[model samples]
Target: MPEGPETHALADRLATLLVDERLTHVRFIDPGLQRRRALLERQRVLAVEARGKALLTAVAGGWTLYAHSHLFGFWRFVDDQDALPDGAPPRLVLATVRGVAALYAAPSISLWRTDELGAQPYLAKLGPDVLDPAVDARALLAHMRTPRFARRTLAVLLLDQGFAAGMGNYLRSEVLFQAKLSPHRALEDLATNERRRLANALLDVPRRAYRAKHDDALPPGKDYLARTRAQFGFEVFERKGDPCPRGDGRIVEDRLAGRRLYWCPGCQQ
Candidate 1:
C-alpha cells in the first residue's frame, strides 16, 4: 500500500497540474461512481490535499473527490501535449485543459459535498496527521497513554491509524529503531525517557520520509551518511543480514503486527 508520504507526493504533483484548471471531462470506470460525473464537470479544481493515505481533491463546484489507492493501486498523469499510456483503462480519470490524471487499480473513489467532508467515515476516525506541522507532540503521547492504547505493542500501535495517522510498515520499523525501542514491547513497559523518545520519533520519522521523498533533501538537522547518497535514510528497514549501523549485530527481520519489521536487536534492546 502507498503510505501517507507516497499519497502526499502524488497529491502534490497532481495539484501543480490540476489546480485552477477546469475539468473538461470526468470518467468513473466503476458504475457506482457514474453519478458523481456531473458533480465535477465544468468545475475548477481548487486544491488537492492528503489525509492519511487518502487524496482529497476540492472542486469549485462545492464538492470534493476522494481517492484511496489501496494496496497495489497507483496514479498516472499525462500533460496535455503528451500521449497517455496504452494499456488497461484506469479505474478513474479526471481530465483538465492542462493535463489528464488517471487512477489505476484503486478500490475507493467517491465524491462528497465539501461542507460535509468531516463526516466521512474514514476521515472522521483518523488520528492526528503526523505530517501536519501543527500536530501536538504532547497530545499524541496523551492519546497513547489512554487505557485502550497503553497495553498494545509499539508495532501494532504504530500501525493503528487511530493512534497516529500516516504510519505504515517502513515508518513503523524505522521509527521504533530510532527510538531504540523493541517492537515487542508494550507502552506500559516503556520508561519515561523511552516514551518521550518514541513520541518524538513517531512525529519525526514520517515527516523526514516525506521531505526526503518530495524535496530530495534531508529533514532539517539530519546529516548525510557516507554509504547512501540519501540523507539520514533507513537505518534498519530492508537491511536484513547487513551490518547494523550501530556497529553491533547484523540487522534482522521478524513478523510483527502481520508486517515484516527490521531492526538491530543488539542496539534496539
Candidate 2:
C-alpha cells in the first residue's frame, strides 16, 4: 500500500498532469460512473490533493473525483491517447490536452458533488493529514489528548487514521523509534516531554519521507520509487536483526496491530 507520503507525491504528479487542464475525454469502468461521464468530460481539474491515503481530484462543474489505490491499484501516464497501456483495464481515465492519465485496479473510485463532499464516508472519518502544512505539532498534541486515543497503545494508536491521518506501517516504527518510546507504551502513561516528542516525530517523519520523494537531484531511473525509498532511509524500519544506527541495540521486528513493525528496543525502551 502507498503510504501518506507516496500518496501526496502521487497527488502532486497528478496535479502536474491534470490540474487547470480541461478533460478532453473521460471514461470509467464502473457502469454508474460511466453513465455520469458527462460530469467530467470537458471539465477542467481545479486541484489534485491527498487526504491521508486518498486522492481527491476536484473538477469543474461542482464534482470531485475520489480514488484510493489500496494495494494493487496503480496509475499510468501517456503523452498520447494511442500510447495508453493495453494490459489490465483502467478503473478510471482522464485525458486532457496535454496527456492521458489512467488509474488501474483501484477499487475506490467515485464522483461526489463538491458541496456534499464532506458527507463522503471516508473523508469524513480521516483525522488531520500530517503532511498537510497546516497541521503542526501542537495540533497533533491536542488531538493526542482525545479520550479514545489516550488509552490505546502507541503500537495500535499510531496506525489509527482518526489518531493521525497519513500514518502507516513504516511510519509507525519510524515515529516510535524517533521518539525513543516503546510501541507498547500507552499514551495515558506518557510523560509530558515524551508526548511532545511523539507529537514532533509524528509530524516530522512523514514530511521527511514526502520531501525525499521530491528530490530532483536523484536521476529518474526505471524504478523511481525504489530510488526515493533508499533516499528516505529509515532509522529502524526493515533493519531487523541489524545493529541499530544509534549503536545501543539491534533492530527487532514484530507484528503489532496486524502489521510488521521494526524498532530498536535498546534505544526505544
Candidate 3:
C-alpha cells in the first residue's frame, strides 16, 4: 500500500497535470461514481490533495472525488487518453488537455459534496498528517501524551493511523531507528528529552521522505545533517545484519505488530 509521502507526491504530480485545467473527459468503472461522472467532465479541477493514503480531487462543481489506493491500487499518467496504459479497466480516470490520470486496482472510489468531506470515515479518523508543513513537534508530542496512545508500545502505536495518519511499515521502522528508541519502549516510559527526541524524529523522518521524493536538493539556506540525507538510502530498514551507523553493533530484524522492522540493539537500546 502507498504510504503518506508516496500518496502526497502522487497528489503533487496530479495537481501539476490537472489543476486549473478542465476535465475534457471523465470515466468511472464504479457504477455509483459513473453516475456522477458528469460532475467532473468539462469542469475545472480545483485541487488534488492527499489526506493520508487517499486522494481527494475537487472539481469546479460542488463534487469532491475520493479514492484510496489501498493495498493493490496504483496510478498511471499518460500524455492523452489514447496513451492510457492497457490492462485492467481503470477504477477512475480524470482527463485534461495536458494529460490523463488513471487509477487502477484502487477499489475505494466515491463522490461527495465538498463541504461534507469531514464526515468521510477515513478522513475523519486520520491523525495529524505528518507531511503537512503546518504540523510541528509540539503538536505531535501532545498526541503522544494522549492515554490512548501513551499506554502503547512504540512498535505497535507507530503503525496506528489514529496515532499518525501517514505512517506505514517502512516509516515506522525508520522513525524509531532515527529516534534511537527501542520499538519495545512504551510512550509513557520515555524520559523528557527522549520524548522530545521521538516527537522530532516523527516529524523529521517523514518530511525528509517527502523532500527526497520531490527533490533531493534542500531549499536554499536550510541545512540538514549528512546522515539524514544518507537515510533516504535507508539506515536500518531492509538492511538486516548491516553495521549500525553509530558503529556500535549490527542491525537486526524482528517482527512487531506482525510487520518486519530493523534496528540496532546496541544503539537503540
Candidate 4:
C-alpha cells in the first residue's frame, strides 16, 4: 500500500504540474461516480494537497477530486509522446498543460463539494496525518493518552486511521522497529519519551523519504541494520530468520493483530 510519504510526494509533484492550469478534460471510469458529469468536467485545478494517504485536487469552480490509493493505485505523469505505462489503464485521467496525470487502479475516487469535504464520513474519522507539516506532536500525545486508546496494542493502533492516519503495514512495522517498541505493547505501557519517539519516527520517516527522492540520494540507513544486513536497505520488517542487526540474537517473528510482526527480541524489549 502507498503510505503517507508516497502520497505526499505525489501531491507535491501534481501541485507543481497542475496548479493554475485549466483542466482541459476530466474522465471518470469508476461506476461509483459516473453520474457526476458537471462536477467532473472542465474545471481549473486550483491546488493539489494531501491528507494522509489521500490526495485532493481542488477545482476552480467548487468541487474537489478525492482519491485514495488504498493498496494498488498509483499515479503516472506522462507527456503526450509517452504511452500510458503498462498495467491497467487509469480509472481517471486529467489532461493538463504539463501532460496527462493519470490515476490508475484507485479503488476510491469521487467528486465532492469543497465545503462539505471535511464533513465526509471518511475524512471526519481520520486522526492527525503524520506527513502533515503542521501536526502538533504534543497534542497528539495528549490524545493518545485518553482512555479510548490506552488499552489498544501499539501495532493495531498505528493502523487505525482514527488513531494516526497514513500508517500502513510496512510503516507500522518499521516505526515500531525504529522506536524499539514491541508490537504487543499496550499504549498505556509506553513512557512519555517512548511516545514522543514513536511519533517523531512516524513524521521523520516520511519527510526523509520525500527528501531522499528530491535529492536523489539514498535515505539515511537505520543504525543497527547498516552494519549486519547483506541486502543493505531494510532494517527489520522482512528480515525474519536472518541475524538481528543488533547482533543480540537472530530476528524473530510473531503475529500481532493478524499481521506479521518482526523484531530483534533481545534489542526491542
Query: What is the C-alpha lDDT profile of model 2 across 1-269, one tens digit per residue?
Result: 88998988888888888998999999999999999999988998999999999999999899999998888999899997789867788888889888889989856998999999899888899888888878888998888878888788999998988888999999999999989999999999999999999998897788778878777543222132333243467888888899999899999999999999998888886
lDDT of 4 at 115: 93
Which residue pairs clash within candidate 2? Answer: none
Which tens-of-lDDT digit does each residue in 1-269 have in candidate 3? 77887888888889889999999989999787788788889999998888888899999888899999889998889998878766688888888889888988856888889999999999998888887666778888888777878779999988888888899999998999989999999888999899988888888888778778745554322243223442365799999999999999999999999999999999895
**What tens-digit string does per-residue lDDT give for candidate 1 at 1-269?**
87777777777788877888888889898887877698899999999988999899999979999888889778888874247677777888888877888888746888899999998888998988887666767977787777878889898998998888888999998999889988989898899899889988887788767776744644332233112223447789999999988898898999988899998888886
> CA lDDT, every prediction?
0.82, 0.87, 0.85, 0.75
Q: Which residue runs of candidate 3 sit more than 4 Å off their true CA positions?
A: 216-231
lDDT of 4 by residue, 45-111 (tens): 8889888788999987899988888878878788752567776667888877678888877458878
Q: Estimate candidate 4's alpha-carbon lDDT, on a 0 to 1 scale.
A: 0.75
Q: After the best TM-score superposition of candidate 4, give how far the Cα of residue 245 lies from its true spot, in angstroms.
A: 3.1
Candidate 1 residues lying further than 4 Å off, grouped into runs, are 216-232
Provide the global lDDT of candidate 1 against the true structure: 0.82
Query: lDDT (0-100) at residue 178 of candidate 3?
Result: 85
Worst 10 contiguous positions by lDDT, candidate 2: 219-228
For candidate 3, give the lDDT of residue 91.
Answer: 84
